[model samples]
Target: MTSTLALDGIKAKQQKTWASGDYGAVAALIHPMAELLVQSADLSYGARVLDVAAGTGNASLAAARCGCDVLATDYVPALLDRATDRAMAERLPLSIQEADAEALPFGDGEFDAVLSVVGVMFAPHQEVAAAELARVCRPGGTVALANWAPDGFIGGLFKTIGRHVPPPPGISPPPLWGSPDRLRELLGGSFELTITPRDFVFRFASAAGLADFFKEHYGPTLKAFEALGDNGKALYDDIVALADSSNVATDGTLKVPSRYVEVVGIRR
Candidate 1:
């Protein structure tokens, strides 16, 4: 077991990393995944929903648009600031707050549906985050997730970043949540889950363009590249190479299909 102190340190660093760049800009390309997730959650009107580790309220806003009362939470309040701005502009029933995925402040069974779209999977203490996700949902309620698969572009991107700036020794890789077997081990006790493999295609003008976008707007990617220091060119070249190798577009544009697992679990 990881010491509480170690976990806390990891969480603190995560908050800072996420707060660094404009994640809202990066999340925009993947916003459709949130719509797909909310559609499968089977949420009823007036249902209380919690979006854990919500980066700029994609899932929360989607749920809110369906008439569900949605609260978007993340440890990094600065990121939630963007979510709050969007919620206000859209007039959706989406509220924003700073909350940790591993130790959510809400009461057990407080929400009718709990969600995290490419969110809580980033929690270093995966087990604790999974437990909190289950704990906050009412019996028979829904718990939906969209996790990037290990074999996908996002996973490969992380791996590329790790090769340059390795992560802490004990943190569980976020992509583990992409596997059905791992999901079962972590969440099956509390929910009856339906898992489906899906792809989220990323579109950009060019491979180099996509790499630049991520390096500029994605916090984790930005930080990873920054950490590379004098070796930053290697990371840039690798990111470009990864995108170039996976490019499915033919007309001088970038089209990479990243796989993710969409899960809709019923609270048991």
Candidate 2:
């Protein structure tokens, strides 16, 4: 039932929100997760790295700081622009390009490593994207990917919210990849797979902080609500109220939980 609804939503909004600048601000919320995934890649200085769906270059910049030659690509030009600007500001030699994950615009075996932090699952075609990642990485190169864990706090939250709002057509809620079996299914045959589970606790100083986060980061949710007509505004209000009630500290700190699946695949 959840899968039916989620896929419906994905098909409706995959083009507009998932593949656009709408996701830029949410990048910060995922930074901690990205850092962990990047570290798991075990990158060394001068490594040739490609970051797929590299929104705002968090992982790419982190790799560059370690002296890796990084190329960050995303389908959204606005995200690439922001990522490029950030690289320039930091004086990192990171290249930013606009490209799709399933059909990357690079020659075969072009990179020593490829990483996608909290990105690839959103690919309209995850299997094709996995194949592409395998295609670009030379034998013995590494491919690191991270995805959200289902049944975690964030997952529960989204599930709750999703129950209130009708999901967009054709999108199913994403599968949790925290399990090794699922990771194997996603990238098993193409590379040697290792799965790592990591948790993130988002601490917000106050309810206002949560509100500000929603205002800034929940672009797709907001857009989805708006598209729902009059019911959307009411639903948005309900969501905010729910968030407000979930505030844990009077001093303005709210701990929101998240878990991720970090899969390291050595190209075969």
Candidate 3:
């Protein structure tokens, strides 16, 4: 498959997973990091904020709560729908839009701030997405991007899965905006960048709980499993077994680890 086709396939799986609402339950997983991003933002009350790839509006909602007029955009309509519902329920002044990160629908310099938590790294073209982010922000406005650390727990999980399941032809994995040097490279020049390390731990009741959570919440892998044929099914089973065996914890709580690199860029 061509690179675009591969990305579409992955996107399709992600839409299905997020549409299931399982993602909403795991919102807490990134809560601390999200709060950090917002607090660090020091946004003004009337700021026009754009939350790109705003999955279920975790960061967008937080920004809205901070009194900013927020626009939450995502490629997946289902995820946007969920975010819209969430905004209505919470009485937040937030609008949902279907927009690609690489090609934002808004005009130039329209937003006072742009924030994405664990979102931009999934863009098929990181450079294009980064440029787009800078393009939409007014001069001196802030653009904050957060992504997982490649050497952290979540990174290890993806590495493990990638080892077992070969990617579809021509489809490279998403760019990881994890390291400080890498984040600077991807996002510098357009904006002045600040990188910080943030970490979190998820405690599951049991290994089985952790497996089920993984099966449900880890969108890409679950989608990969759904894409598999009969032979692929066997391989997926072995992979699951391997993951389960590795999920040993002394007490009942399965301690799954995670870390993030939050990059803040001020428009120059």
In order, candidate lDDTs are 0.91, 0.73, 0.76
Instruction: Between candidates 1 and 3, name the one with more favorable lDDT.
Output: 1
How much does candidate 3 score in TM-score?
Answer: 0.86
lDDT of 3 by residue, 1-268 (tens): 3576666776665556556536666765766777789888888899999999888888998898899999999887877787888889998888888988878999999999999988777776567788899999999999987788887766766666676566545543453678777677777888898888876666777655665676666676565556564545554555445445555567755665567777888899
Which window of 10 residues has the lowest lDDT sum in candidate 1? Answer: 91-100
TM-score of candidate 2 on Cα atoms, chains taken together: 0.83
Over 4 Å off, model 2: 1-12, 18-22, 164-172, 206-208, 237-252
Best-performing candidate as measured by TM-score: 1
Using lDDT as the measure, the top candidate is 1
**Across residues 1-268, which tens digit of lDDT does each residue of candidate 2 receive?**
3363564455446545654334666776677666777788888789999999887888888888879999999877778888888889989898888887878999999999998887766665556677899999999999988777775655654565677665554443554445567678767888998887776666777545665566446655655555676766555666556556654555656766566678888999
Off by over 4 Å in 1: none
Q: Flag clash pairs in model 3.
A: none
Q: What lDDT tens digits, residue by residue, belong to model 1 across residues 43-111?
A: 899999999999899999999999998889998887788898888899776778788898899999999
Over 4 Å off, model 3: 1-21, 169-172, 228-252
- What TM-score would each prediction reach against the true structure? 0.98, 0.83, 0.86
How displaced is residue 64 in candidate 1, in Å?
Answer: 0.6
